[model samples]
Target: MWEATLPSSRHYQIFGYPRVQTPPPLNKRRVCLRFACPSDLQSRLTMRRRASLRTLLAACLAVHVGCYVVERGDTRVNNHVLREQNLVLEERAENSVHSLIKVTESTSTTIPAPQCVLPPGMAEEIQGYQEVVDRVIDYVTTGDFKGQVYSHLANLVDTFGPRMTGTGELEAAIDWMVEQSIAENLDNVHTEDVQVPHWVRNNESAWMTLPRLKQLHIMGLGSSVGTPPQGITADVLVVKSFDELKKQGLKAAGKIVVFNPTWESYGVTVQYRSQGASEAAKVGAVAALVVSITPFSIASPHTGQQYYSVENKIPVASVTLEDAAMMERMQARGQNITVKLIMGAKNYPDTISRNTVAEILGTHQPKETVLVSGHLDSWDVTQGAMDDGGGMMMSWAALVVMRKLNIRPRRTVRAVLWTGEEQGLHGGIEYFKRHQHDHEQFQLIMESDSGTFTPQGISFSGTPEATCIMEEVLKLFHRINATQLTNPMTGGPDIAVWEKLGVPTGERHLARGLYYSYLTNLLHILNELFFYVFLALHY
Candidate 1:
C-alpha cells in the first residue's frame, strides 16, 4: 500500500502519506476542505471529484492514520451534511513528514487545529526513542569535541601554517589529516591524489611615494604577475567601481587604478577583488589595487585569487581598507597621490595533492553513503580557521562522535577532507570525475566549509520531499534550535559536482558570529556534532 503525492516541481516521488480521494458531490456545492498538514494536499486535490464519499473517508484514514485527529461534523459549512471525519496522521514508519495542521473549511469548524503531534507509537516506544536521542545529545555536548578539534586545528595551523594549493604545506596537512583520522579510529582512512596549480605570492609591498610618505599594508593577489625590479611608480586613479574606471577611458592609462567600492555583502563586494585587476588592465592601467574584502579590517590586507587577461596581465594586489579610503580622500581634496608597487608574485608548474577520505561502514547498506566533508586547503596568508578550518574539524568530530556512540547508520557515512578548495575546488572536481559513476549510491553530500559558529539550520538542495523529511528529522533537535530548513539547498563548491548529478546535498548553517570568530570560537563544534548525531540516528 505504498502511495505518496509530491510537489509538482520535482521529478521524483517519495512514499509517505496516502493519496487523498475526493468525495462525490453530495449536492451541487462540493465543499473542498483543504488540509495543510501534509504540505502536498494541493497537488493531491486534483483527483478529488472522482471518488465516492465513503472512499474519500477511507483514503483519508489510511493516509493520515496516526498523525492527525479529525472530529465529527468538522467540515459543516453552507448547509452541507458533514458526518464523522477521521484525522489521519502520515505514518513515521515509512516517511516522517512534519507539517502544521491547517484546515481550510468552506464554512468553519468548532474544533481548534492541533498544534503538535507525535507519530503512531506506544507511549513506551515514544519514550524509548526520546531517551536514545537525549543520550546521544548529552554524550556529544558533554564530550570534549571542541577542545580536541581546536587543539588539532591549532596544531595544523601552527605546524603547516598556510595550505596554499600545490605547496608542501598543503600536502603535509593532508597527510596529517589522514593520521588524525586513523587516530580517531575512523575506518578506511586514505588520500586520493589531486593535481592543483601553484601560485606563489613572494615579497610584496606598496607605499605612497607622493602626497604623504606612508607605507601601505598590502598582500599581493594570488596568481598576479610581478613588476620590474625598479617597481611601478604611477599617479593613483581612484574609482568606486569598474563602471567609473571605464568612464575614465584613456585617463586610466599609465596610472595605478585603485578601487574603493562600498561594502555591501561578501558576494557583492568580493567581485571587485576577483575582477578588479583585469578590468583595470583593460583600461591600460599599469597596476591595480583593491580594498581588502573584509568590511572591517585591522590593517590586514585580505589576499585572494584574481583572474588576468592574457594580453592585459599586470601587477595586482589587495591594500588595507584604510589605505584605499585614504587614497580616495586624497583624490576628493584634488591632491595628486602616487604609489610605488613592487611584487614577486608568480605562477609555477602544477603540483599533485590529495583529498583525505575516511568512512564508517553502514550496518545495513554499506555501499550507499552519506557524505560529510570540508575543504582542507586555505589561502596563503590567514590560518584559514574561520574560512573553513572550523568546518573541517566539525566534520571530523561528527565521525568521531558517531564512532564513540557505537552507532552505525543504515548507510555508510564517509568523511572527505578536501584539498585545493581555495584554489577553486580542484580536489572536489577530481573526486567527482573518478567516482561519478556511483553517484546514485550517494544518499546525501553534506559540506560545512562555510564556518562553524553556531548551528542555525541546514540548507537543502533537493526535492520538497527531501526537505519534508529533513524538517521532520530536525524536530528531534528542537532543544538545540537547529530544526529550520530552507528550500533549494544549493550546497557548497565541493559538492557542486555531485549536486549536478541529482544527488541531494546540504550544508550546515552556522550563525553570523562564526563568520568573524571562526577558529577562535569553540561553540560551533558542539552544534555541528549535534547535527551529525541527528543524521546518524535518523537519516
Candidate 2:
C-alpha cells in the first residue's frame, strides 16, 4: 500500500510502489509468494541466475525485524517493501517490527517495523516534607530575613554598577560575596577559577545619513565586532524578519541590514539580536542593525549577546524602537535610507573569572548536593540588577536564611554565584568540567537566571518518576499559590551542561516578556518568597 526504501549501504531493494507481477525466465529462480487471503493473491519475486541470498540479519537487529534481501533489476540499493497486511508510515516503519520473519534462499515474504514512544499527582514521600516547607515559607515571608533580599540587592547594585565578565568590578563583587558568605558562618566558602570572554563597549554610535542627518540611539550587542576607524557608512536594507531578509538577500550585499521584528514573546523575537548579524553576513551584508528586542520601548535600546559566523564576522548593534520603526517607514515610502555605524567595541584575550561558592553542609548526607545557582555577571548596559541580580541575590539569600535559622537539608545546599554566564556559560562549563566526575553526587541542579518574576512554578526536565516527585513538592506551595511545574521548552541555557549529562535540572519559569518593566520594578514580594519554597522543595 506504501513505498519505502532502505539505506544504500545495505544490499537489498524493496519496493511497494507500482505493484505488478512480472514474468521471469526459467534460467533464473522465481519465488512464488502466495498469500492465504479471503480469496487468494500471489506475487513474483525475481532473483538472479545464481539468486544467492546474503545479509547479516543478526547484524541488523535481533527481535521482531524481518530482514530480507530483495534485489530489483540490477539495483543493489537497500529499500523497505510494505507488507500486505497493513500500511505504515515510512518514518515509523523502521522502529517497530510487528512480525518476526526473514527471506532466505527459501520462499518467504513479510516485513514489519513498529515505533515506540503528566503531571502532578503528588507522591506520599513528598507529603512528608510539609512541615519543613511551611517553615521555609514563614521564614522567607515574615521572619528575620523577610525584606533583606531588597537591601542586599540594592547594596550589590550600588556597590558594583555592571558586573560584566572579565572585569575588575565583577571580581570585587565575587570577593565581597565570598567574605559575606564566610561572615554568615556558611561552611566551605571558596571560588572556582574559570576563563571568560572580555569585550569592552565604548563610543558606540549610529546616525541616519541618507534620509536625514538624525542621530540614532543604539546599543552594541555583546561580543559584536567594532567598525573600522573611519566607521561603516552604507545604505540600509530593512527587513521585518529573517524570512524577508532571505527573500531580498541579493539587495543586502554591502548594505547594513536592519531587523525590525514585531512585538512577540522574547523567545520568538530575540532571534534577531542573537543571530541577525551572522545571518545577514551570510547574505553578504556588510553589517547588521537589529531593533531593540523589547516589545515596548521608551526610546531605549536593549542589548544581548550575538554570535558571529566565523566566515564573515560583521558589526552588529541594536537601535531604539523609535529609530528602527522610523527607518522602516522611510523605506516603505521608497526613500533611500542610509546610516553610519561607529562602534569602538574591542575583544581582549580570554581572562580569568571566579565562580563564588558558599555552602550549608547537610546534617546527614554531606556528600550529596542540592545545588542552587544564578549567574553573577551581566551585560554591560546598566547595573545588571533584574536580569540576574535578583536571581543571584535570591539564591544567596536562601543560603543566608537557612544559615540564620540554623536549618540544613538532608543534602548539602550549595549556592553557586556563577561568573561569565552572560557572555556565554564560561564559568558554568568550567565548573561542570571540574565536577562532572561527581555528577552522581549532584542530587539536583537549580538555576534562576531569568528575572525573579511572579513565580508560577519550576521549569524542569527529568524522568517521569522525578516529575511526579517534583509535582508533589510543588503542591506544598499552595499557601503561596506558586505551584505549577512546566517545561521551559526553548529556554534553559545556563544549566544546559548538566542537563545533558543526565543530571536532574530545574530553572525558575517566570512570567517573562515583561523584562523591560520587571527590571525597574524590583519590590516583587511573591517573586522573593517563591525562591525560598523552590530551594526547600529540591531538598
Candidate 3:
C-alpha cells in the first residue's frame, strides 16, 4: 500500500491503517488485533494529522531560538566597541584638562615686584608729586601749554621735509637743532663734525611681462647703482632665499634674481634687506629685487640700506607685495616672466655731518655725567615722526621737568641728539672715540631710539642687584602703567657705545605702536609728573 507524506512534518502515514481496541488476555503481555472498518481508518488518519502539526510547531521553535542567540552575540560585540571608544574619549579629555591646569599654574606663579616703596618722612613729598603729575597730564592733554617746543618741532618738519644722511635737508635740520638747543639755555650746545657717504636714487621702475603684462610699483634700494641709460632687461629667476640660489648654480647667472622670502618677525627678516643684494651679486646675477617685507600692503615703496660686495656689485630695488605675488603665481604656472630694471642711484664722496650735544650741569656733582640721547636723522621716505621725533621730544621734556622741579641730580644730565645713526651709527662711533679718555666719569647713559609709543618703564644694563634697585625706584610709575622692568638691557644704538666703554647703560621701554598717537596732548602731563616724582625722590 502507498503512504502519504506530510510536507510540514516530514512524517509518513499508511493509506490503510486500522484502529484497534486492546483487551486483556490470560498472559499480561498478550494483545489482540481486529480488522478495521472504513470508519476506523478515517479516525486513525485524523489522529496522525494532529501529531504531524505538533512536530511542525517544535521545529519552528528551535529555529527561532537559534536566531535569538545569534542576535544577542552581535549586540555584545557592538557594546564592546562602544565601550572602547568611550574610554579613549575620556582619556583625551583628562589629558587636556591636565595641560590647561599646568599652563594656568605657570602663568599665576610669575609675580612682578611692587612700585615705589619709599622710606619714612617722605610721605608728604610723595603726595605733593603725585598731585603735580595728575595736573600736568590734564594740562598737556588739554593743549593748555602750547609752548616754544611745539613751534620748534613743527618748524623743523616744515624746513626740512625728509632729511636723509648726506642730503641738504639733513644739514639744515642740524643747524635748526643747534640753534634750538642754545635758545633753551643748554650749555656746550655744539655739533661734533662727522663725514657721511651719500647714495642717490635717480630713476627706477619694474614690471612683469609674461603670462600677463602688468606695471609694478618699486623703489631703488638705498646705495644701489643706476642701470645703464637703456636699463637691463632679462628673464626673471625667482629664489626663495640665498641658500636656494647656490643650489641652482649657473642657472641663475645672467638673470635678474628675485628674493621672495617672508619674515616671521621684524628682527629676523631684516637681514634680507641688508644682505640680499650682496648675496644675489655673488651668484653672477646682473640685478636683484626684493619683495616688500612689511605686513601691510599700501602700495607704498619701502627703501632700506643694501650691502654691496667689494668684488661684485649690482643694482637692487624693492617691489610692492602685490606685484611680487602676481609674479610668483605666473612663475609657478611655468610662465617665463621678464623684468626691465632702471635704477638711477649713485654714491658720492663723503661729506661733513654733525652730532649735536647739549648739557644741564648738576649743582651737586658737575663732574659725574648722565648721558641721555636719541638719533637725529631718519629715512627719506616717511615722516619718521614716531621713529625718533617722539624720542627727541621726550628727552627735551624730561630735561625741562628737571629744571622746573629744581631737583638737581648728583650727576650732570647731558642730552645728545646723534646724527647719521641710520648710516651705520657713524656719529655714535665718533662720539664714543672722542670721549674714550673721559669715559670713566660717565655715571649712566640712556638712549631712547625706539619709537615713542608709550612709557613702559626701563631696561638696565648693570649688575643684577643694581637693576633690582632701579626696578624698585621705577615702581612709582606703576600707577601710570609703566610696570615691568626688564634685565640685561639691549641698550639703544647711541648708548651701546657708552656701554662698551664700561659706562652703565639703560633704555626706556616705550609701548610700541599707536600708543603715542595722542602724544602731543599728553606730553605736558607726562613731563610734569616725571619731574615731580624724580625730584622728590632724589632731593
TM-scores for all candidates: the values are 0.74, 0.75, 0.70
- By lDDT, who's the top model here? 2
lDDT value for model 3 = 0.57
- Could you tell which candidate, 1 or 2, scores higher by lDDT? 2
The parts of candidate 1 lying over 4 Å away from their true place are 1-132, 144-146, 513-530, 533-539
Error of 3 at 346 (Å): 0.7
Q: lDDT tens string, model 2, 194-227?
A: 9999999988898999878999999999999999
User: Measured by TM-score, how close is model 2 to the native structure?
Assistant: 0.75
TM-score order of candidates, best first?
A: 2, 1, 3
- Candidate 3, residues 98-215: lDDT per residue as tens digits? 0000001112111122233445645454455554455444444344443434554556666676667888888888888778777767777788998776877766777666556777
Residue 31 lDDT, candidate 2, scale 0-100: 28
| Superposition-based RMSD of candidate 1 using all C-alpha atoms, in angstroms | 14.6
What are the runs in model 2 whose C-alpha is more than 4 Å off? 1-125, 488-490, 516-527, 532-539
What is the descending lDDT order? 2, 1, 3
Off by over 4 Å in 3: 1-151, 404-407, 513-539
lDDT of 1 at 80: 11
